[model samples]
Each structure stands twice: as structure tokens, then as C-alpha cells.
Target: MPNAAEILVDTLIAWNVEVVFGLPGDGINGVMEALRKNQDKISFVQVRHEESAAFMACAYAKWTGRLGVCLATSGPGGTHLLTGLYDAKLDQAPVLAITGMQFHDLIETFTQQDVDLTRVFNDVSVYNVQVSDAAHMENVASLACRTALARKGVAHLSIASDIQEQPADAAKRSKRNRPAHTPQDMFAPHCLAEDAELDKAAAILNDARRVAILAGRGAIGAAAELQDTARLLKAPIVKALLGKAVLPDDHPYTTGGIGILGTLPSQQAMETCDAVLIVGSTFPYIEYYPQPGKARGVQIDCDAQRIGLRFPVEAGLVGDAAETLRALNKRLEQKRDGEFLGTAQNSMQKWREMMHQSEDSSAHPLKPQRVARAFGERLAENTILAADSGQNTELAARHVDLGVGQAFGVSGALASMSCGLSYAIAAGIAFPGRPVAAIVGDGGLAMQLGEFSTAVRYGIPLKLLVIKNNMLNQIAWEQMMFLGNPQFGCELQPIDFAKAAEAMGGKGFSIERADDVERVLDQAFAASGPVIIEALVDAYEPMMPPKMPRDYAKNFRKALPQTPNRDLIEENVARQPAKTMMEAGE
Candidate 1:
């Protein structure tokens, strides 16, 4: 029989979908039944929340280099998927969203939680299709997959309730020989002075006292290639946190990701470098980045328009980072006279030392930095770290040393709050068997802590460390820094997270004093289900040493005529641990 649900599943299988993350509901009963019958072909992962389902798909796609698929019922269930979908879209991950719609007539007329799925998702999605009939289901489904994979973003496809129950064609058909779209031809628009621009960029590099490479998320795919280039040029790699995987933190070329919340090395490198190579990332922290006139910039991007759009570019290349690097590396002459590479390597060591010092968790009120680092030490190589926005991301980014197989998930492009729990759920499900931890703020945890119910319902073993400060500390700190004093609206009447977890059938413990943090976390580690370890830290402890106006002014200073000594980084690392150990009374 040609039922719509069978046809949809056939089409999904044809599209090479191996997994679907979703929660079943009445609206999609037919589809659910069909999927259940064919469980051997496609695995349906039952997630607690639709948002986590979507995020899980996104994580799988990002990690496996495949298109992720997520499904949900109508209205609110469908709507909940948006936040995670937006995260996938912004991060350039391929996620195909399937949602069930109510009966056609009931849609706008308000029939039992009916909502306009297409209209709501259109703005947030790269492409959206709402099928009114079952016959064209295969075409629509294929288009949705193609859109998501081709654009590297989110695509939403909605099927009406009635249509899903209709009989489908016996066999699914596909176009094996589809023509690909023509690549953009921007070269014609900017054919002026190509050779001259290359000459200028090369001259800047040759004459530069110090050079630094800034890799954004776009550069993540080409991290190692970029590192090779950086090593050859003797430049430190300053990545954005979204660009976390580009250069391994252990690499001497990595100076740490740059921003206002940047590590000391990133800021220091940006302050002194004469030549900057900008790749893949449209980092919004322009104030922290080198200004247009301050340094010679060479920008590389997939879209030519992005190159030099933010900062003035002395030269720009429009291509994939890996492709561009291959070409750029060809044109460069290595000064291997041991002048640049040696110095940059020495400076990198010093910067890592200083970071270890700052991450020292020895104090009366525990710094989030030390806690995150200690947690990192206890975690496995393949463990997934789910980080929330604001201070959580900052602390995890600066302090967490990722192992070869480890990956950290954060709301980079969307910068969404409360993404921590959802991220953990998806990452945990996608990576199954690997321990997943959510390092979140008290305020951020409250955002989607309701979903902990979902985690408990599924009996997924996930760890959550809540930095409970009894306030929206990041917001309060920002307000204090930018607007004289902290303003209202930052206060959060604290709740006991541990108790809340117990109420929801998960383990939760409320630990206020610093001494009790690790004990609770250790207990949670041993617990079988989702556990919340709430550490009551200061509202804003270790506030990043409060950057002053003078420090800000140094950004505008000219690139120094000499490269920094790498030995300083080694010294910093050597001194930091001993200092932390003494302070920790270890």
C-alpha cells in the first residue's frame, strides 16, 4: 500500500538518512508506525525535548560529516526545534528538519494546537517546504536534504496530517544524474590589480617583524593546513573559540582564540603583530581584532564579499580556506633562516604558562576557571563538553585542554543561552558511551532546565555542573563594565538544582561552599542517571583582570618592529602550576 508515511520513509532512505532524532506524537502517527516497522533501516532516537532532538542531529552532522535529520509533531513541538535549528544554521552545519502539521483546513483556523509551521520556520531556515499532498513527497524531501547539505545549514520540511496517511507510490524514484549548480563567478567583478595585490601582501609578510594567523569557524576544516602554514611562517595561530578545533591547543602555533574574553596570548599577539592572516571566521569582536589601519590584513573567505568587509584588507582571496591555503602556501617564500618560527614558538610557550596560572583554582570562593580545568582532567579523551554562553564559554575556552578526540559544543554563531543542556543531550546521544558534561551558569541553566525532565525521562546518563552564583552574573558584569554600575534585571532568586533534579527523577545536589564542589560532582559521576552538581561560586569571581582604558588603547599601537620571545610562554607554564598547587594547598 502507498501510504504517505511509507513514501516519506522511502524518500528519507533514498536521501541516505541513517538516523532521525524525534519525539512521536499523534500528528505524525502514520509516519511513526512506518518508521517503527522499518527500524532496521533507520534508527529513531527518542530525545526528551524536540530542541535536543534537533541539536542532536546538528551534533551528529557536525561530528560525522553528514547531514543530520530531526523530526517533531505539530505546533509547539515543532517550534521547540527552532532554537537548535538556528544554532545549526549559524554554525554552518547541515540539518534537515521534518515536522508534522495538523490537517490542512485546521492550520490557520486554530484546530487543536494547529499552527503555520512553514510560515514560522521560513525566516529561520535556509529553505522550507510544506507539502499539501503526498504524491510529491519524494521530490520535496530530496530538495530539503539537498538544500541543507549544499548550503551547509538548516532546511525545514513539513507534511500535513492527512497527507501522511494517504497511500504512497510502491517504489521511490531518484535522479541519479542531477546537474550541479554553477559556482559563483565573482572574479569578473574584481579583476583589477590582482598581481599588484599579491605583490603587496607578499611584501608585507617579508617585511613584517611579527605575523599572526586568525582562523575563524570557517577555517575549522583546514585547521591542520593552517597550522602548517603558521609554522612555516613562524606566526602564532589566534583562533576564535568557534574555531576551537582549527589548531590543537597543545600546538605551539596556537596562541589561543581572540576576543574581549580572549586569553592573554591572543590579546598580546594581536597587539604586537604586524601582519594578520584572517580566515573563515566573521569574528564580531572587531574592537578586539586589529583595526583597518593598524595592521596589514590578508583575508580569506568562501564568499568574496566577506573578505575585507569588516576590516580593511590589504589583500583578499575568495575560496575555501583549504583551497586558498594550498595556493597561498605556493606563493610564499619561507624565510626559514630560523628568524620567525623560533621566536613565535617561544612566545606560545610563555602564553600557555600564563593561562595555567590564571586557571589556578586555589581560593576561598572557587573560580569557575579552576573547576572547569579540574573537570577536564577527570573527563575522557572522547568526552563531549557542552558549554553555555557568557562566562561558561569563556572559562571553558580558556581553561579546558581538549584531548585529540574530544570536542566542545557551544552556541557560537547564535550565542544562545540555555543551549548547554540541549547540547549535552544531543552530543551524548550522538556519541553514545562517551561521557558528556554540561558546564553551565546558574542563570543559563534556568533557561532550559525544564528539559532536564526530558533527560530524566529517557534515562540518559549525562553530567551537569551548574555554576550557581544566584545572579545573571555575566549580564551584571557587562552592565557594570559598560554602564557605570550593575543595573536591575540581573538578579535570580536562587533555586536548589540538586533537589529539582531529584524531583524530576534525576540526581541533583546543592553545593554552596567551594570545598564541597568536587565531592558533589564526583558523586554525580557515579550516579546512573542525569545528575546536577551545583557549585555556588561568586557572582563574578576572577573577572578577567578587568581590562582598563590604557590596555584598550594599546590595540591602536603600531605593530612592534621585533617578534616576542617564545621562552616567555614556557616560563609562564612552568610557574603557573606550582603557583596553583601552592594556592590549592595540594
Candidate 2:
């Protein structure tokens, strides 16, 4: 008979989970032993921090539409998984988090690692439970996995130490009173809106002369359908940050991203269009969207709750993005007038030219945009790009051009730091032979630099582009623009990230001058094993939005005299479109 720990591992294998990311501790000795015994069935990836394990699991689920599993011990180890688990919860990724508890008998007796994990995980998990009996181990594990996949969120199961070591009870398992065995394979149902609903949506869309389409993460696998619909409607597709890879940036119909990290053309299209079709996007910036009654709206989302959550829609179609778009396309009339899309495309071209000028700057201190551009140009066709949350995200959103087979993601919704490296590591583990890269700001990378060793230990060939500015550039700009205050408490001491990577048994490269950006990135990308390219960037480079708010300009002007390096900040601001476009109205 198999022990409860073995039963849990076997259940995971039945679900076709290929890898489990976690750290070992005394409380999980039985589970660790079971994993060691079944090494050939599944792979165990040991990470430095429990947080990284969770982040890796979330990223794994995001890239591959499969259940990502992560494990941790009792107390602090289990608690440490909260941040990353929340990332999965907010991003709607399917992940199973297995945690160990203290002995079954000593759970509430002030044991060394006896924390109430169920209560702690309640908010983050779609299904949270603790296993008390060995006979119920498989049942609980199966339920957790099913619920996670069904809900597209986190599922947690905490096993007691004593129960983990106990043998499965054959008598209890064979009892007819037990529930029916859950199937190993699960598939998403094909959901589509009713014919009348589709007709209503199609009528609204076909009546409008100037229409705009907004795509989000739910539209990921529907690229072909999305493009076909855009062509039929003569609509310009504006992507959310998470949906940046839905359509390539250089595509003729795409206006790129929206919101703070958006292109000028995307913002202009949203404001001017008479009608909007929002596909699987919950873009929160209400100010950037077409005013409430300005445009007749239609929205599509897999989850019914998210439909019309951001913008008021005349037709709220509840179904899969691709299916709904395909059905709607059949009903829509092909627009012969191409003026709206052509005008948007022309604005996108101008935006691209301005961006190229920034990327080709010959300044003494390297521009971060240039680094991102070089990194994007060097990526392989199948490379997966993970971007950290900061100014680097802005740079990547604008400059990184994803190719046909490429993938890109950020800690969307949660916007957590320290997730970039873990995401890259997970991508490498999931795809193996394919290339993976991370674009991280200095502050974000400093949060989880220890994970570099995890990549080195696993021999994952990861290319890291560290944009070194020695400051929390995003927060500083927000203080100046949003609060009418000078930057404060945002400065960071400089560190040689290249040297740090070399010390951790990985290859390292540095780029100080603007001319060295391309050569260093090429060398780092071509290097065997893991490599880090730390590029020193100018700190005063502003992350400007496409259309600057009036108050933001007033605030920035008020803080200029008090701000450090005002000349450099002003110089960069002059080159941005915000100055000329501000008076055009928000």
C-alpha cells in the first residue's frame, strides 16, 4: 500500500504535472521522501525562496495553459507563498499549492511550525483545505486540482506531518460510501452566446462607421480570428499590456497598448471612435476609454462578471473570445471605408518613428529604450519575454517587438516586483530548448537576486537584461507628476550586477556607453548557460504617457526646481510627445 505522501504525488502524476517547484523542510520530510522515490515520474525544482516557487508556478501556468504545482513546508514557508499565490489569483492562472503542516496531534499545541494555513490562504485560494486522514488524501488532491483549473485560480492543500507518513487505508478507500473517482482529464467547455445576443452585438458593430477593438489576455489564442474580425470591420486593434502579444506590434491593424504604457495612436483611436468592441479586456483606466455615452460599446469575456465591468456595453457577450469573435464575424458586414483604420495606422507610424529616434539616441548614459530595443531585436523566434513591474515595463511595452512565435507577460493586475526572474526561470523550465529572457529594473531585480542561483543550478539558459538606474524611477515620476512633489526616498545605491552574476557562477556582461548596448546584448544572448547583461541607464529619463493630464504637467512644473537633475529631466521631456499633445485635451 502506498503512503499518503506517495498517494499525493501519484495523483499529481495522473494529472500530468511534469514539474513541482519548492523547498524542503522538516515538516515535509515524508513528502520530500516520496518525491525522491518517484524522481523518474516527475521533476523537482529547488528554489532559494518559497516566494520564488509560487511565482514560478504562476508563470508556468500563465505560459502553458496547464496546472502549475508548487510545494512548501509548514508555517513561514507556507506563509511566504502568499504574494506569488495572489499573483496567480489576480491574473487568473491555474496553480496548485501544496503545503505541509505540523504533526496532526500537535497542530494547536504551540508546535514549532503550527500556523493555521487554511485561514491564511482563504483569501487567495479558490479552493482551500487541510488533509486530516490518509484515506482522503487522493480525494482532496483531486478536488484541489479540479477546482483550480475550473476556476482559473489558486488551489491550496495543507497536509499534516503525521498523516503524510501514514499508509493509505484500503478499507476506507474501497467503501461504497466514498464519492465517485474524479477523472484525470479535464477540458474547458465550448461556451458561446445565444444567436439573438450575437445578432444584437453584430447590429451595433455593423452600424458604426468608425469602430475600435480592444483586446486583452483572454484573446491570446484567438489571434487569427481577432485579426480577421479587425479586417472585416476595418477596426484598429488596441491591446492591453497583458495582451501585447495577441497581435505583433508591427501588424498593420494594431495600434499597440493602452493606458500609462500605451502608444499615442491607441489612445487617439479610443477617444475618437464612434463605437468600440472590447474583447476579453478589463482595462481599468476609465479616463482613457471613450466617454460613457460617446461610443456604443460591445464586450466579450469568458467570465460573465467581467463583461461590462470596465465600460458600459450595449451588448455583453458571455463566451470564449475566439468563439464569440468568429460567430460575430459571420454577422458583421465588411466595411468598405478604410479611413478610420488608415488614420490610426498613420498615427502608429509616426509613433514608431519617434520611438525609433529614442532608441537610436547617442547620449553618454545609455537610454533604457535603446536597451529594450536591442534586446527585442536579438530575441529568437520562440523566445519568451518576461518583464518586471517598473519603468522597464513601460520601455518593453513600447519598444519590444514580439515576433510570430514569441511570448510576453508581466505580473499583470498584481504588478509585483521580483517576479521577472522567476517568470523567466519557469518559461525556461516549461519550454526547455527555447530561449527565455527577462527585462528587469535594478530595484525589482534586487528584490529576488538570490533566484539567479536557482537558474544556474538548473542550467536554464536565461538572458537577463538589468536596466541599472539606481533609483525607483516609476515611483519618483509618479511623485513628481501626480502629487506635485519632488522625488523622495527613491534613490538606491549602485551595485555591479554583472559582477554579482559572475560571482553566482553565471556569465556576465556590462553596457555603459550607448554604442555598447547592441554588442553586449548580442554577446549575452549567444552565451551558453545563464547570462546577465547589466546596462547603466540614465536615471532622469521620464516614462511619459501618450496624452499627459493637465494637472500632471502643472505638478511636474511645480516640482522641477526642487527635483535633482532638472536639466536632464527637462531635456528628456522635450523629446517626448506629451508636451505637444497635452493641449489637444485628455
Report the Cα lDDT for residue 569, model 1. Answer: 20
What C-alpha lDDT, on a 0 to 100 scale, does residue 135 get in candidate 1? 54
Off by over 4 Å in 1: 110-114, 169-207, 303-305, 336-358, 453-461, 502-530, 549-586
Give per-residue CA lDDT, model 2, range 247-332, as digits (tens).
88789999999998998899999999999999988877788899889899999999998888888999999999998998999999
User: Residue 53's C-alpha lDDT in candidate 1?
Assistant: 81
Residues 1-586 of candidate 1: C-alpha lDDT, one tens digit per residue: 6577786787677767888888998877878988998899998878767887887787778766677999999988899999889889878788989889888677778688678888999877898988766556645666777778777789888888788887654323334522222222112222222555556666777676678788887786786678667866778788787777666677777767677555555766777777788888788767767755668888878766577766787788777788677667766767555555455567667656656665664655565666777666777777778888877777777777776667777888788888888778777656666778778988888877788887776666788888887777666545544443423577789888988999999988766655765776677677887888877775535233213343322321211112122243224323443233223221
lDDT of 1 at 320: 75
In TM-score terms, candidate 1 sits at 0.82
- For residue 262, model 2's alpha carbon misses the true position, in angstroms, by 0.7
- The superposed Cα distance between candidate 1 and the true structure at residue 48, in angstroms, equals 3.7
